[model samples]
Target: MTGTPRPRTVLLTGASGVVGRSILREPTALRLLAATHSAPAPEADGRRIRCDLTADRLGLEKEEYTALAGEVDAVIHSAGLTEWGLPAERYRPINIEGTRRVIEFARHAGATVHFMSTAFVAALAETAPVALSEGNMCRNYISSKWEAERLLRDSGIPHTVFRPTNLVGDSATGWTSKGQIVQLMSDWICRGRAPFLPAHAGIRMDFVPQDLLSKAVLRAIEQDVSEGEFWVTYGAEAMDMDASLRVLAKHAAYLGRDLTIPPVVDPDTLTAEQLAGLRPMVRNYVAVLRDVSEVTRCSGGVLPSSMPELRTRFGVPLVDDATAYLRSLEYASAHLS
Candidate 1:
């Protein structure tokens, strides 16, 4: 009788990132080769490889690169800059060129690739039916991701692109990477410094816990086919602005603080004085909120229908929106301060 077949060895980039670590936590039959740019790599089960995606050959030596290429059956490219305010020039090397290098490496290794991208790649439209499907126009950070996707598609390597929306903390412990824009907003709200927000009732905000996203990624790797685009999101089940604030208010009540819900201001109708009332940091989000509101107004707040089917097929759990928001607030309260 044949012995049990050995588990396929997969190389994972961005092993130090939020989603990367989450993927590392899940038990899987695959042997992981985790790559990191920093000195001290994650203390996990994988064979840690020090490599930079932006560097030539991912900064790996000739022998090391050849050995890795021979061993890896698949590659998951999750490492990249996600900061919003950075210029396109700054993001080009890491998000765009880095992806090109990843595809190149995958081709050499004869391995399939899984690319992590954001749902904002759909971009925001000014008119109705803002359906977030493939091939939408976006700019800045999102544009970098779009360009990377294009490179992957044209690379002639077997690949799947996953577009997840706003990622919250862990579903259970609410642990997450600090310095996200959501953390800033939560901080302002908890401090009672934010008196008003530019939002609309119809605006829908999608959030996926890192745990669920990681699981989905792993499933995609294990059940890999030639190619597909998966939108890892809650779709129409996502919470609206008012509902999200209510959840935050509930968390505030649990903490024994009577928080006043901020009034929503329409971005288009805001007077100069009204804009001046917002905190300097919060003011930057005005345009973002307006764009989202416009998308909601046009699309009736509907995400793609295939999202649910994909989530189910991948065994991703349906996270409770209120719990996810509360856990995020709790983590933000303790750490963001």
Candidate 2:
């Protein structure tokens, strides 16, 4: 038999993250050089390269860089620190400096680059309604991403940047994961996390499933969109947790299960004292559930002027919000204890 075609090589930084892992499932004719600070448990494909991006030298010597440079066709910079506890200085070294290094390597290696940025970089005035477009000025995470995007655009390399909203989906089964609001509500119902539901249950939230995100990443590469940021997310009407939870409770009630689903108040209406009295855990819970945005022309929302308009866009074909809620419920029921 003839030899298998030489796989196009992709160097991905965060290969083990929820979205990064989904990307591995796609059948691409590429050999992936997976990089991480530490070793993850065994996965099906790719050669693992252990290099702490934060190290003084990035753990990559000249010879190693040259060897891999010859093999890689593209770089997908997925590794990043997502939690907010870290100091800004700590973020720059990895999120910014490490990115600089990867772009440098790509320049030498003759490979296109794909960078994973988040939607929060579009931090609008807390007082301003969420004005999320690729070019909207970001004060926090957005600053780092925007800085990196500037460097990439000037680097003269073919690149694609994706700023996705909150990601959903089971990391294991390509289904929904329990960390989502719907699952959180299901748990609050089933596990009795609270005697009452959140006050902001009616607020709209935007999310992108990991499977859809994976497809978008591959699509971006195949279509070779001009170098700029694109928002990869669903355009479905944002689901209010309070309303969706009622739907879930009804589904359970129809199944002959006994449960108490309380009426949830919209967070926008809560007084400061009411919010302050919430348990610390409950406060943390609200932070993740409360913020949401619709980031596409598909949603009839305005795209940012600075962000390059994507000629190739993948429309999300999810079921209605109710069905999406229920599918999320089924996901919650399966994974949550």
Best by TM-score: 1
Expressed as tens digits, the lDDT of each residue in 197-315 for candidate 2 is 43332234444456656666776665555476677543335555555566667757754676676556454565678768889987655543333322221123322221123323643
Report the Cα lDDT for residue 136, model 1: 22
lDDT of 2 at 220: 62
Model 1 C-alpha lDDT versus the unseen true structure: 0.75
lDDT of each: 0.75, 0.60
How many steric overlaps does candidate 1 have?
Answer: 2
- Clash count for each candidate, listed in order shown: 2, 6
Pairs clashing in candidate 2? 14-79, 121-142, 170-175, 199-265, 200-267, 201-242
**Per-residue lDDT over 45-97 for candidate 1, one digit per residue giving the tens place of the 0 to 100 score:** 75899878779999999899989999998998989988765667989999999
Q: For residue 291, give model 1's deviation from the true position in Å.
A: 5.6
- Candidate 1 residues lying further than 4 Å off, grouped into runs, are 1-3, 39-43, 124-138, 177-179, 276-279, 285-300
